[model samples]
Target: MHPLPAILIDGLRATLFRHPRVSATTVGAGMFVAVVVVYLFASILLEMAGTSPPWMLLPGGVLTVLGDSMLTLIAAWLLAVLAARREAVWGIATVLLAATVAAAVVVHWPLGELASYLVLHEHAGLAILVELVARCWWFFVLLVFAHWLAPRGLGHALGSAVLAYAVSAAAWWWLPQSPLVRTMPVVQATAEPTSGDQDGDAKTATEQDEADDDDAPGAKSEFDAEAAMYAQPALLDAALARLKPQTPGKVDLYVVAFAGDAQQDVFRNEAEYVETLFAQRFGAAGRTVVLENNAATVTTRPLASWTNLQRTLATIARTMDPAEDVLLLYFTTHGSDDHQLLVDLDPLPLNQIGPDDIADALKTTPAMRWKVIVVNACYSGGFVDALRDDSTMVMTSARADRTSFGCGADSDITYFGKAFLAEALNRTTSLREAFDLARTSVDAWETADQKDAKPDAKGVAGVEPIQHSEPQIATSASIEAKLAAWRRTLHESAAVPFAPAGEAMSRGASPSPDASTRSGKG
Candidate 1:
């Protein structure tokens, strides 16, 4: 063979037979197969339901296959982007996936329903295949896209796609069914009444009479009156007595209470107590911005939104030195695994305000010399983990595995809030001291009551306590002085310099001492 032809052949072999490229192509092909399987299975289910016309089903199948292919492609693109550390591409792919899923769910409701029913019927062969396809197709798509787009060529794409597929499959298999699915209605046959039911009816009537007695006016009045007494101003006063310092305005305080939902009344009672405590000790006059029973306001608006509470904090920060010693944050609400401080709205993703995100936000805010964030909620300790910073002190009502407790149509203030307010009102204890005491007491209560329900009570007990993790009150003076000096330097450096003669005039420079001296002489 000629030398040039032999060289060309060798180069072609090296390029075409590369492991990475072959792997990527293989993964992409696999994803295509998976998607085709899902579509066919879904189509068969729809046909069985008699809802799909043969001709219409064909087009539906095509669209489903096409949609799945796009999803796979997008997934492959994402995998590749992630592998290459291409943030923009990854973000775009994520958003695209979310949008596509949302749209497909809306557009193919009937198809999903049919597929769901088929799976529910426990058709092992069809269900297993469909699930496998649904789970694996996205990985292949991502691999193919990555291979096409990634700078490292096919190998990187293939590796990433395979990894993503494994992860998706594992998650799909392990994840619990959605709440809706778990609560699905089971059909049952109705039974006819018999003559023997008369005895049962007589007993029911007697039970109803007893229930009415339990709900009589006197009994209801006594319960309501006692609840009102517990929620009275005196209880708040006691709470403040515990939380208050000897000097007023010595510490800046922020209280965020999320009530409403089905648990408004309970929360309302707690809110009232907390407010009263602050009022008595801190002089409720200007210290508090109570978000009274407003779960919607807290959850719906982003933290950056111009909520009344946010506005108040901004004003306070503006008025005080950025480095002033101040206790900055207090939050009481429901929390979820996703790290969302859930209130009235559905749980938000924890990623939205992860500990790192909270740290970043606090770093920029100039108002507080020291930041103290207290979260009273189920799984609230997770917030502490996310919000911890050199400048922050964190406290949570419960650990990540536990639930905060209280009952009253979900309206009563939670046990965590109640304990917290009680300690705060004492006035002798500092914020740090109060949080420690609260955590200890709450944990003890949860442990004692829920010992048998260990898993269920995982988060009920607050754990991993840290006292004065950031700048404590003792070091506040020195930190404040240093901050002041830095601020002065910043201001001095930022001052515009004076220029001379025509140069100064043209540039609109302010007059300097030297210029004034020369002008006076002239």
Candidate 2:
């Protein structure tokens, strides 16, 4: 063996055999060093990938890594302290032997699966299991060592492990929110498109197409919407045919329902309800589109894949007088830690949507100057950082590290969607006001849930302390003025009646004049 390797092995052996008292200071230093090294390596790999945005490379990225390192060190130090306490009662040899056995057990643990579950936030039962283990696995290892060192029975070891795990988890939960991970404000002066910029005659072409569609020889008498909502060129042409020229200064509304399979029914329900609400409020019955993947009979058009979504958005952008229209896009789905919003309707493959996907699409449609984007999913706050711009307002259900609740199949709406879209929008005319009210409602709901949470052997039942979703909102300065103008228009329009008590909107309704109606095309 090389001299350095031999020396390192000898040192380890000596430390094990001598059973030296491991001071808290020594353990703290070692853990801190290890954590820093691990995070440093991770940051290097991130840089090498060239995938991180510019913001991440500087203060944001650096801060995130530091926060992560601190979290890791905190967990490690807690375990070390427990191990030391046990060693004091027995001897170092027992602690070392126990650590070896614990290492073996940990090696057999399903860590990879747990990590996947955390990112995807699917399979609720599995999520609970993963959360339980992830939060306390370190304590479990330390407990094994403690048990051996102190000659404690398994029951005593379990109790001590739980207690230690709880304290450490509480500490982590109480840590101040990291400044590294924060919302970036959009600089309106630089980001907004100039008025004099003219791209092409696309707007004129769309107007002509809409005028021609009003005299169609034949059109579908009613919408026979199907499961696959992909845009065939012919279908798209037909759909765009009936759009009329947009009225000057009209704030037309367009909705996109991005659904994932995890909470299919809930997503579909919210999409349908919002479509109805907007149709009535904006006189935009034909403008809204529901692209969903539930196994339902034919209420919603099927969004076959990511291509369909992109095509639909492009069509809407092209058909509408983007300069005068306001697009209200509602995306409800699961979210990944990698900043992807999940889009699925199983067996058929669907591409996941990332923050860049949305930003890129918006960039392509500079004519649609005003946007209200609501992302109803876990970890959605990550989207705000990427999607924020002078003409857009972004609201997300939860911060990047949190998961929103009430997305199960049995639920009617996600906590954010219900509060922001269904209830607040109806009660208040202002989008920003709705957002404020929705955020407060969500916070109260989460607080109540957390208060009732009780951890068991598996995890908390009916509630989770760490699963509280912290909703986020980001708006550009320019959008605030635009939104205020839109609010006035909304209030002036003939308002839709609230849904009758104990009932939401009907599941199905007859189709509208044309998809371009929101743009006043036909």
lDDT of 2 by residue, 1-522 (tens): 542233223223322332223432323243334434443444444333323333332354455445544443344444445555522322222223223222222421234345433433324345445545544444554465445434557876566556544543344443422222212212112122112111110112122123223222211123323323433333444444444445566766677666654224566667666767777765556776665545441232445234556556666766775655777888876565455665544334455667866764553222356688988876688899887766778989888766677764346677788788777877777888888999999889877766676777777464324445778889877778766776666645544443421245353454433322000000
Candidate 1 lDDT tens digits, 402-504: 4456522322446666556655336332455565566566666655554453342556533322211121111234334433432242211121222212243
Best by lDDT: 2
My TM-score estimates for the predictions, one after another, are 0.35, 0.50
Shift of residue 410 alpha carbon in model 2, Å? 2.0
Candidate 1 ranges beyond 4 A from true positions: 1-263, 295-309, 345-367, 407-411, 451-522
Question: In lDDT terms, how accurate is model 1?
Answer: 0.38
Measured with C-alpha atoms, the lDDT of residue 107 in candidate 2 is 29
Model 2 CA lDDT for position 45: 48
CA lDDT, every model vs. true structure: 0.38, 0.51
